[model samples]
Target: MNELYKVDTQDPVGEVWLLSDFQNMRTELCEGERCIYPNDLTKTLFHKDLPRFPLLVKYICANDWLSVQVHPDDELAKSLEGDPWGKNECWYFLQKGRIAAGITRQEKPLEDLRNGDLRILTPERGDLACLQAGTVHSLGPGSKVIEIQQASDMTYRIYDWGRGRELHLDKARVATKAAASAIVIEEMRKFDWKYFSIELTKKVEGSGIVITLSEVPELHVLIDDREEFSEEALLVRPGSFWSELL
Candidate 1:
Protein backbone atom coordinates (compact mmCIF):
# COMPACT_ATOMS: atom_id res chain seq x y z
CA MET A 1 0.00 0.00 0.00
CA ASN A 2 2.92 2.37 -0.63
CA GLU A 3 0.74 4.74 -2.63
CA LEU A 4 2.24 8.02 -3.76
CA TYR A 5 -0.79 9.69 -2.17
CA LYS A 6 0.50 9.10 1.36
CA VAL A 7 1.66 12.38 2.89
CA ASP A 8 3.85 11.74 5.95
CA THR A 9 7.42 10.60 5.42
CA GLN A 10 7.68 9.24 8.96
CA ASP A 11 4.62 7.09 8.34
CA PRO A 12 5.63 5.66 5.02
CA VAL A 13 4.94 2.21 6.40
CA GLY A 14 1.34 1.96 5.29
CA GLU A 15 0.70 -1.75 5.81
CA VAL A 16 2.26 -5.07 6.88
CA TRP A 17 0.96 -8.44 7.98
CA LEU A 18 1.53 -9.95 11.39
CA LEU A 19 -0.15 -13.00 9.82
CA SER A 20 -1.78 -12.97 6.45
CA ASP A 21 -4.20 -14.69 4.12
CA PHE A 22 -1.91 -17.20 2.37
CA GLN A 23 -2.64 -16.49 -1.26
CA ASN A 24 -1.03 -13.03 -1.27
CA MET A 25 1.57 -13.19 1.52
CA ARG A 26 5.15 -14.41 1.28
CA THR A 27 8.02 -14.51 3.76
CA GLU A 28 11.70 -14.14 3.04
CA LEU A 29 14.13 -16.67 4.54
CA CYS A 30 17.27 -16.66 2.43
CA GLU A 31 19.53 -14.50 0.27
CA GLY A 32 18.37 -16.19 -2.92
CA GLU A 33 14.84 -14.70 -2.77
CA ARG A 34 13.42 -17.57 -0.76
CA CYS A 35 9.70 -17.12 -0.16
CA ILE A 36 7.45 -18.99 2.24
CA TYR A 37 3.69 -18.57 2.52
CA PRO A 38 1.89 -18.34 5.88
CA ASN A 39 -0.91 -20.76 4.96
CA ASP A 40 -0.38 -23.20 7.81
CA LEU A 41 -1.09 -20.78 10.69
CA THR A 42 -4.12 -19.19 9.04
CA LYS A 43 -5.56 -22.56 8.10
CA THR A 44 -5.13 -24.02 11.57
CA LEU A 45 -6.72 -21.00 13.19
CA PHE A 46 -9.86 -20.90 11.01
CA HIS A 47 -10.10 -24.57 10.02
CA LYS A 48 -11.02 -23.74 6.46
CA ASP A 49 -9.50 -22.87 3.13
CA LEU A 50 -9.25 -19.08 2.97
CA PRO A 51 -8.04 -16.83 0.22
CA ARG A 52 -6.11 -14.49 2.51
CA PHE A 53 -5.79 -13.45 6.11
CA PRO A 54 -9.03 -13.22 8.03
CA LEU A 55 -7.95 -10.15 9.95
CA LEU A 56 -5.87 -7.30 8.50
CA VAL A 57 -3.94 -5.04 10.84
CA LYS A 58 -2.25 -1.87 9.62
CA TYR A 59 -1.24 1.70 10.44
CA ILE A 60 -2.84 4.59 8.56
CA CYS A 61 -1.01 7.91 8.78
CA ALA A 62 -2.51 10.56 6.57
CA ASN A 63 -0.75 13.83 5.90
CA ASP A 64 -3.73 14.79 3.78
CA TRP A 65 -7.38 13.83 3.64
CA LEU A 66 -8.53 10.46 2.33
CA SER A 67 -11.48 9.54 0.16
CA VAL A 68 -14.89 9.33 1.83
CA GLN A 69 -15.99 5.70 1.59
CA VAL A 70 -18.17 2.96 3.05
CA HIS A 71 -17.72 -0.80 3.33
CA PRO A 72 -20.47 -3.38 2.67
CA ASP A 73 -22.30 -5.12 5.44
CA ASP A 74 -22.37 -8.91 5.82
CA GLU A 75 -25.61 -9.64 3.97
CA LEU A 76 -24.98 -7.30 1.09
CA ALA A 77 -21.38 -8.41 0.87
CA LYS A 78 -22.47 -12.03 0.57
CA SER A 79 -25.21 -11.41 -1.97
CA LEU A 80 -23.18 -9.06 -4.13
CA GLU A 81 -19.57 -10.12 -3.80
CA GLY A 82 -20.13 -13.79 -2.86
CA ASP A 83 -18.01 -13.23 0.23
CA PRO A 84 -19.65 -14.31 3.45
CA TRP A 85 -17.64 -11.98 5.65
CA GLY A 86 -17.93 -8.20 5.55
CA LYS A 87 -15.56 -5.67 7.05
CA ASN A 88 -16.10 -4.31 10.54
CA GLU A 89 -13.11 -2.37 11.78
CA CYS A 90 -11.95 -0.30 14.70
CA TRP A 91 -9.39 2.48 14.72
CA TYR A 92 -6.95 3.17 17.55
CA PHE A 93 -5.74 6.71 17.27
CA LEU A 94 -2.06 7.37 17.84
CA GLN A 95 -2.31 10.98 16.71
CA LYS A 96 -5.86 12.22 16.40
CA GLY A 97 -7.89 15.08 15.09
CA ARG A 98 -10.96 15.24 12.86
CA ILE A 99 -12.22 11.95 11.39
CA ALA A 100 -15.59 11.56 9.68
CA ALA A 101 -17.82 8.76 10.92
CA GLY A 102 -21.48 7.70 10.62
CA ILE A 103 -24.09 9.40 8.52
CA THR A 104 -27.03 11.82 8.71
CA ARG A 105 -30.02 10.81 6.70
CA GLN A 106 -31.67 13.01 4.11
CA GLU A 107 -34.16 11.99 1.49
CA LYS A 108 -31.89 13.26 -1.25
CA PRO A 109 -29.47 11.43 -3.46
CA LEU A 110 -26.41 9.55 -2.17
CA GLU A 111 -24.06 12.19 -3.54
CA ASP A 112 -25.76 14.91 -1.47
CA LEU A 113 -25.48 12.95 1.75
CA ARG A 114 -21.74 12.30 1.31
CA ASN A 115 -20.42 15.41 3.10
CA GLY A 116 -23.47 16.91 4.76
CA ASP A 117 -24.57 13.77 6.62
CA LEU A 118 -21.24 12.96 8.25
CA ARG A 119 -20.22 13.74 11.83
CA ILE A 120 -16.72 14.53 13.10
CA LEU A 121 -15.40 13.14 16.33
CA THR A 122 -12.18 14.32 17.99
CA PRO A 123 -10.28 11.45 19.54
CA GLU A 124 -7.06 12.00 21.43
CA ARG A 125 -4.27 9.48 21.76
CA GLY A 126 -5.43 6.11 23.18
CA ASP A 127 -9.01 6.64 22.05
CA LEU A 128 -10.72 4.01 19.91
CA ALA A 129 -13.46 3.98 17.32
CA CYS A 130 -15.43 0.83 16.64
CA LEU A 131 -16.98 1.20 13.23
CA GLN A 132 -19.72 -1.28 12.47
CA ALA A 133 -20.29 -2.69 9.01
CA GLY A 134 -21.63 -0.22 6.41
CA THR A 135 -20.52 2.87 8.31
CA VAL A 136 -19.20 5.65 6.10
CA HIS A 137 -15.86 7.11 7.22
CA SER A 138 -12.92 9.20 6.13
CA LEU A 139 -9.61 10.37 7.59
CA GLY A 140 -8.12 13.84 7.43
CA PRO A 141 -4.62 15.29 7.65
CA GLY A 142 -2.40 14.86 10.76
CA SER A 143 -4.17 11.68 11.79
CA LYS A 144 -2.24 8.52 12.59
CA VAL A 145 -4.49 5.50 13.02
CA ILE A 146 -3.97 1.85 13.82
CA GLU A 147 -6.73 -0.02 12.01
CA ILE A 148 -7.86 -3.60 12.57
CA GLN A 149 -10.50 -4.80 10.16
CA GLN A 150 -12.03 -7.90 8.63
CA ALA A 151 -10.04 -9.23 5.68
CA SER A 152 -12.44 -8.13 2.97
CA ASP A 153 -11.34 -4.97 1.14
CA MET A 154 -14.67 -4.29 -0.56
CA THR A 155 -15.27 -0.53 -0.33
CA TYR A 156 -18.17 1.44 -1.80
CA ARG A 157 -17.26 5.02 -2.42
CA ILE A 158 -19.95 7.61 -1.75
CA TYR A 159 -17.80 10.54 -2.72
CA ASP A 160 -14.07 11.23 -2.94
CA TRP A 161 -14.18 14.98 -2.47
CA GLY A 162 -13.27 15.32 -6.12
CA ARG A 163 -10.50 12.70 -6.09
CA GLY A 164 -12.14 11.51 -9.35
CA ARG A 165 -12.41 7.87 -8.31
CA GLU A 166 -15.48 6.07 -9.57
CA LEU A 167 -18.38 6.51 -7.17
CA HIS A 168 -20.48 3.51 -6.25
CA LEU A 169 -23.79 5.20 -5.58
CA ASP A 170 -25.83 2.14 -6.46
CA LYS A 171 -24.13 -0.20 -4.05
CA ALA A 172 -23.57 2.45 -1.40
CA ARG A 173 -27.27 3.13 -1.21
CA VAL A 174 -27.88 -0.46 -0.21
CA ALA A 175 -24.83 -0.80 2.05
CA THR A 176 -24.89 2.38 4.20
CA LYS A 177 -26.81 2.56 7.42
CA ALA A 178 -29.56 5.13 7.68
CA ALA A 179 -28.73 6.14 11.24
CA ALA A 180 -25.11 6.77 12.18
CA SER A 181 -23.32 3.59 13.20
CA ALA A 182 -19.94 5.09 14.09
CA ILE A 183 -19.14 4.62 17.76
CA VAL A 184 -16.72 6.58 19.95
CA ILE A 185 -15.35 3.91 22.20
CA GLU A 186 -16.42 4.75 25.75
CA GLU A 187 -14.69 1.84 27.46
CA MET A 188 -11.00 1.05 27.76
CA ARG A 189 -11.60 -2.50 26.57
CA LYS A 190 -14.31 -3.56 24.16
CA PHE A 191 -15.03 -7.01 22.77
CA ASP A 192 -16.74 -6.05 19.56
CA TRP A 193 -16.70 -9.33 17.61
CA LYS A 194 -15.20 -12.81 17.44
CA TYR A 195 -12.62 -11.88 14.81
CA PHE A 196 -10.61 -9.66 17.17
CA SER A 197 -10.68 -7.72 20.42
CA ILE A 198 -9.19 -4.40 21.61
CA GLU A 199 -7.91 -3.72 25.11
CA LEU A 200 -5.62 -1.20 26.75
CA THR A 201 -2.85 -2.65 28.83
CA LYS A 202 -2.60 -1.14 32.29
CA LYS A 203 0.56 0.61 33.36
CA VAL A 204 2.40 -2.03 35.36
CA GLU A 205 5.23 -1.01 37.69
CA GLY A 206 5.18 2.45 36.09
CA SER A 207 5.77 0.85 32.69
CA GLY A 208 3.23 0.50 29.94
CA ILE A 209 2.46 -3.12 29.10
CA VAL A 210 0.73 -3.56 25.76
CA ILE A 211 -0.65 -7.07 25.45
CA THR A 212 -3.17 -8.86 23.25
CA LEU A 213 -6.08 -10.69 24.84
CA SER A 214 -6.51 -13.54 22.39
CA GLU A 215 -7.90 -17.04 22.81
CA VAL A 216 -4.97 -18.52 20.95
CA PRO A 217 -3.45 -21.45 22.83
CA GLU A 218 0.17 -20.34 23.05
CA LEU A 219 2.41 -17.31 23.13
CA HIS A 220 5.37 -18.22 20.96
CA VAL A 221 7.96 -15.59 21.69
CA LEU A 222 10.84 -15.13 19.33
CA ILE A 223 14.18 -13.95 20.62
CA ASP A 224 17.74 -14.06 19.27
CA ASP A 225 16.39 -15.41 15.99
CA ARG A 226 14.70 -18.34 17.74
CA GLU A 227 11.15 -19.30 18.73
CA GLU A 228 11.44 -18.44 22.42
CA PHE A 229 11.51 -15.50 24.81
CA SER A 230 14.30 -14.32 27.07
CA GLU A 231 15.16 -11.18 28.96
CA GLU A 232 16.67 -8.89 26.38
CA ALA A 233 16.44 -5.44 24.90
CA LEU A 234 12.73 -4.88 24.38
CA LEU A 235 11.56 -1.79 22.53
CA VAL A 236 8.11 -0.30 22.22
CA ARG A 237 6.91 2.72 20.29
CA PRO A 238 3.61 4.30 21.28
CA GLY A 239 2.12 4.44 17.75
CA SER A 240 4.47 2.65 15.42
CA PHE A 241 6.36 -0.62 14.91
CA TRP A 242 10.07 -0.88 14.20
CA SER A 243 11.77 -4.28 14.06
CA GLU A 244 15.34 -3.00 14.25
CA LEU A 245 17.27 -0.22 15.96
CA LEU A 246 19.74 2.10 14.37
Candidate 2:
Protein backbone atom coordinates (compact mmCIF):
# COMPACT_ATOMS: atom_id res chain seq x y z
CA MET A 1 0.00 0.00 0.00
CA ASN A 2 2.46 2.63 -1.19
CA GLU A 3 -0.45 4.97 -1.82
CA LEU A 4 -1.23 5.39 1.86
CA TYR A 5 1.83 4.20 3.79
CA LYS A 6 5.11 3.45 2.07
CA VAL A 7 5.24 -0.21 2.97
CA ASP A 8 5.07 -3.49 1.04
CA THR A 9 3.78 -5.95 3.58
CA GLN A 10 1.36 -8.74 2.66
CA ASP A 11 0.64 -9.40 6.32
CA PRO A 12 -1.03 -6.95 8.62
CA VAL A 13 1.28 -3.92 8.75
CA GLY A 14 1.78 -3.63 12.47
CA GLU A 15 3.02 -0.01 12.74
CA VAL A 16 4.80 2.83 11.00
CA TRP A 17 6.07 5.37 13.49
CA LEU A 18 6.09 8.76 11.79
CA LEU A 19 7.42 10.79 14.70
CA SER A 20 8.41 9.51 18.13
CA ASP A 21 10.97 10.32 20.78
CA PHE A 22 11.32 6.80 22.21
CA GLN A 23 10.21 4.26 19.59
CA ASN A 24 11.56 5.24 16.17
CA MET A 25 14.43 3.39 14.55
CA ARG A 26 15.02 6.17 12.08
CA THR A 27 17.37 8.85 13.34
CA GLU A 28 16.46 12.48 13.52
CA LEU A 29 18.05 15.16 11.35
CA CYS A 30 20.76 16.59 13.58
CA GLU A 31 23.34 19.28 12.78
CA GLY A 32 22.93 18.73 9.02
CA GLU A 33 23.62 15.04 9.66
CA ARG A 34 20.88 12.44 10.09
CA CYS A 35 21.00 11.08 13.64
CA ILE A 36 18.58 9.74 16.23
CA TYR A 37 15.82 11.99 17.62
CA PRO A 38 16.33 14.60 14.89
CA ASN A 39 14.09 16.89 16.79
CA ASP A 40 15.16 18.23 20.19
CA LEU A 41 11.79 19.91 19.84
CA THR A 42 10.02 17.36 22.00
CA LYS A 43 11.14 18.97 25.24
CA THR A 44 10.39 22.39 23.83
CA LEU A 45 6.82 21.32 23.10
CA PHE A 46 5.76 18.94 25.87
CA HIS A 47 6.40 18.41 29.54
CA LYS A 48 10.02 18.91 30.58
CA ASP A 49 9.99 15.70 32.59
CA LEU A 50 8.79 13.63 29.64
CA PRO A 51 11.83 12.02 28.06
CA ARG A 52 10.34 12.00 24.58
CA PHE A 53 7.22 12.74 22.61
CA PRO A 54 4.17 11.77 24.67
CA LEU A 55 2.23 10.68 21.58
CA LEU A 56 3.03 7.99 19.03
CA VAL A 57 1.79 8.84 15.55
CA LYS A 58 1.49 5.99 13.06
CA TYR A 59 -0.08 4.56 9.96
CA ILE A 60 -1.19 0.93 9.88
CA CYS A 61 -2.14 -1.12 6.86
CA ALA A 62 -3.89 -4.42 7.53
CA ASN A 63 -3.91 -6.30 4.24
CA ASP A 64 -4.83 -9.48 6.05
CA TRP A 65 -6.05 -10.03 9.60
CA LEU A 66 -4.71 -8.67 12.87
CA SER A 67 -4.72 -10.34 16.24
CA VAL A 68 -7.31 -9.53 18.85
CA GLN A 69 -5.48 -7.48 21.44
CA VAL A 70 -5.95 -5.28 24.50
CA HIS A 71 -3.79 -2.58 26.07
CA PRO A 72 -3.56 -1.85 29.77
CA ASP A 73 -4.39 1.52 31.28
CA ASP A 74 -1.92 3.89 32.90
CA GLU A 75 -2.43 2.80 36.49
CA LEU A 76 -2.16 -0.93 35.74
CA ALA A 77 0.84 -0.39 33.52
CA LYS A 78 2.65 1.71 36.07
CA SER A 79 1.94 -0.74 38.90
CA LEU A 80 2.49 -4.04 37.05
CA GLU A 81 4.97 -3.25 34.28
CA GLY A 82 6.54 -0.12 35.76
CA ASP A 83 6.01 1.58 32.43
CA PRO A 84 5.35 5.30 32.30
CA TRP A 85 2.28 5.30 30.02
CA GLY A 86 -0.41 3.23 28.27
CA LYS A 87 -2.04 3.38 24.85
CA ASN A 88 -5.31 5.13 24.16
CA GLU A 89 -5.89 5.75 20.47
CA CYS A 90 -8.06 7.05 17.67
CA TRP A 91 -8.06 5.70 14.12
CA TYR A 92 -8.89 7.33 10.80
CA PHE A 93 -9.92 4.97 8.02
CA LEU A 94 -8.25 5.51 4.67
CA GLN A 95 -9.44 2.42 2.87
CA LYS A 96 -11.85 0.64 5.14
CA GLY A 97 -13.31 -2.82 5.28
CA ARG A 98 -14.14 -4.75 8.41
CA ILE A 99 -13.12 -4.20 12.04
CA ALA A 100 -13.99 -5.85 15.36
CA ALA A 101 -13.92 -3.57 18.40
CA GLY A 102 -15.01 -4.27 21.95
CA ILE A 103 -17.99 -6.59 22.50
CA THR A 104 -21.71 -6.56 23.08
CA ARG A 105 -21.09 -6.93 26.79
CA GLN A 106 -18.11 -7.66 28.99
CA GLU A 107 -18.02 -11.37 29.74
CA LYS A 108 -16.21 -12.94 32.59
CA PRO A 109 -13.16 -14.97 31.42
CA LEU A 110 -14.05 -14.06 27.79
CA GLU A 111 -15.22 -17.66 27.09
CA ASP A 112 -14.03 -19.77 24.14
CA LEU A 113 -11.38 -17.04 24.08
CA ARG A 114 -12.32 -14.60 21.28
CA ASN A 115 -15.69 -15.68 19.98
CA GLY A 116 -17.98 -13.71 22.24
CA ASP A 117 -20.47 -11.26 20.71
CA LEU A 118 -17.88 -9.04 19.05
CA ARG A 119 -19.11 -5.91 17.30
CA ILE A 120 -18.20 -6.12 13.61
CA LEU A 121 -18.34 -3.11 11.32
CA THR A 122 -17.56 -2.07 7.76
CA PRO A 123 -16.61 1.59 7.76
CA GLU A 124 -15.81 3.54 4.62
CA ARG A 125 -13.40 6.43 4.08
CA GLY A 126 -13.35 9.32 6.57
CA ASP A 127 -14.74 7.24 9.41
CA LEU A 128 -13.31 7.56 12.90
CA ALA A 129 -12.98 5.17 15.80
CA CYS A 130 -11.81 6.18 19.26
CA LEU A 131 -10.52 3.19 21.18
CA GLN A 132 -9.76 3.93 24.79
CA ALA A 133 -7.42 1.96 26.99
CA GLY A 134 -8.52 -1.60 27.90
CA THR A 135 -10.66 -1.88 24.77
CA VAL A 136 -10.46 -5.20 23.00
CA HIS A 137 -10.15 -4.70 19.26
CA SER A 138 -8.92 -6.12 15.95
CA LEU A 139 -8.27 -4.69 12.50
CA GLY A 140 -9.61 -6.82 9.70
CA PRO A 141 -8.44 -7.15 6.10
CA GLY A 142 -8.16 -4.36 3.51
CA SER A 143 -7.99 -1.63 6.11
CA LYS A 144 -5.55 1.26 5.76
CA VAL A 145 -5.54 3.60 8.72
CA ILE A 146 -3.78 6.43 10.55
CA GLU A 147 -3.56 6.05 14.31
CA ILE A 148 -2.67 8.52 17.06
CA GLN A 149 -2.03 7.06 20.48
CA GLN A 150 -0.02 7.36 23.67
CA ALA A 151 3.63 6.43 23.29
CA SER A 152 3.66 2.93 24.73
CA ASP A 153 4.30 -0.49 23.22
CA MET A 154 2.72 -2.80 25.74
CA THR A 155 0.09 -4.59 23.66
CA TYR A 156 -1.33 -7.69 25.33
CA ARG A 157 -2.04 -9.89 22.36
CA ILE A 158 -4.95 -11.99 23.56
CA TYR A 159 -6.00 -14.02 20.50
CA ASP A 160 -3.88 -14.62 17.45
CA TRP A 161 -5.94 -16.55 14.89
CA GLY A 162 -4.03 -19.73 15.75
CA ARG A 163 -0.86 -18.03 14.50
CA GLY A 164 0.97 -19.48 17.53
CA ARG A 165 1.99 -16.26 19.23
CA GLU A 166 1.95 -16.10 23.00
CA LEU A 167 -1.44 -15.13 24.42
CA HIS A 168 -1.95 -13.05 27.56
CA LEU A 169 -5.44 -14.29 28.40
CA ASP A 170 -5.22 -13.45 32.08
CA LYS A 171 -4.35 -9.84 31.49
CA ALA A 172 -6.83 -9.45 28.61
CA ARG A 173 -9.67 -10.76 30.70
CA VAL A 174 -8.93 -8.20 33.37
CA ALA A 175 -8.19 -5.31 30.99
CA THR A 176 -11.30 -5.51 28.83
CA LYS A 177 -14.82 -4.42 29.75
CA ALA A 178 -18.16 -3.72 28.06
CA ALA A 179 -17.75 -0.30 26.44
CA ALA A 180 -20.22 1.40 24.10
CA SER A 181 -19.22 3.80 21.31
CA ALA A 182 -20.55 4.74 17.89
CA ILE A 183 -18.68 5.04 14.63
CA VAL A 184 -18.49 8.72 13.73
CA ILE A 185 -19.46 8.83 10.05
CA GLU A 186 -19.85 12.59 9.78
CA GLU A 187 -17.55 15.56 10.18
CA MET A 188 -16.07 15.78 13.63
CA ARG A 189 -16.22 18.97 15.68
CA LYS A 190 -13.25 17.94 17.76
CA PHE A 191 -12.14 15.04 19.97
CA ASP A 192 -11.17 16.65 23.29
CA TRP A 193 -9.99 14.62 26.23
CA LYS A 194 -7.45 14.58 29.03
CA TYR A 195 -4.81 12.64 27.11
CA PHE A 196 -5.17 14.16 23.61
CA SER A 197 -7.59 15.83 21.24
CA ILE A 198 -8.11 16.14 17.45
CA GLU A 199 -10.08 18.16 14.91
CA LEU A 200 -10.53 17.22 11.25
CA THR A 201 -11.03 20.18 8.95
CA LYS A 202 -12.45 19.86 5.43
CA LYS A 203 -11.46 21.98 2.40
CA VAL A 204 -9.13 24.02 4.58
CA GLU A 205 -9.06 27.23 2.58
CA GLY A 206 -5.66 28.62 1.48
CA SER A 207 -3.47 28.39 4.57
CA GLY A 208 -3.60 27.75 8.30
CA ILE A 209 -2.72 29.95 11.24
CA VAL A 210 -2.13 27.98 14.43
CA ILE A 211 -1.69 29.73 17.78
CA THR A 212 -0.45 27.56 20.60
CA LEU A 213 -1.51 28.74 24.04
CA SER A 214 -0.26 26.06 26.46
CA GLU A 215 2.64 23.70 27.02
CA VAL A 216 1.09 20.74 25.22
CA PRO A 217 2.08 20.02 21.63
CA GLU A 218 -0.47 20.49 18.89
CA LEU A 219 -0.62 18.29 15.80
CA HIS A 220 -2.02 19.98 12.71
CA VAL A 221 -2.87 17.98 9.62
CA LEU A 222 -4.02 19.67 6.42
CA ILE A 223 -5.67 17.08 4.17
CA ASP A 224 -6.39 18.01 0.58
CA ASP A 225 -9.29 15.80 -0.53
CA ARG A 226 -9.73 17.30 -3.97
CA GLU A 227 -8.45 14.58 -6.32
CA GLU A 228 -6.81 12.11 -3.98
CA PHE A 229 -6.29 12.72 -0.30
CA SER A 230 -2.84 14.25 -0.01
CA GLU A 231 -1.83 15.37 3.48
CA GLU A 232 0.82 17.52 5.11
CA ALA A 233 1.35 17.54 8.87
CA LEU A 234 2.92 20.18 11.04
CA LEU A 235 3.86 19.74 14.65
CA VAL A 236 2.99 23.14 16.15
CA ARG A 237 5.29 23.91 19.05
CA PRO A 238 4.53 26.20 21.98
CA GLY A 239 4.21 29.24 19.69
CA SER A 240 2.56 30.19 16.40
CA PHE A 241 3.07 28.80 12.91
CA TRP A 242 1.60 30.31 9.76
CA SER A 243 1.64 27.75 6.97
CA GLU A 244 1.81 28.62 3.32
CA LEU A 245 0.15 26.40 0.71
CA LEU A 246 2.43 25.45 -2.12
Count clashes in each candidate, considering only residues at least 3 apart in sequence or on different chains: 2, 3
Candidate 1: RMSD over Cα atoms? 9.6
**Candidate 2, which segments miss by more than 4 Å at Cα?**
2-14, 23-39, 105-108, 180-185, 201-246
Best by lDDT: 2
Q: TM-scores for all candidates?
A: 0.69, 0.71
| Model 1 lDDT per residue over 1-246, tens place | 344344456545544444335354543223257444444334444445565536555556676667778888767888989885787787777655568887765566677765556787778766778888878788767776667777677888887778688989888888888675667764334443455655453222221112232211111211123221232211111111111101
TM-score of 1: 0.69
Model 2 residue pairs with clashes: 28-35, 28-38, 29-38
Candidate 2 weakest ten by summed lDDT: 237-246
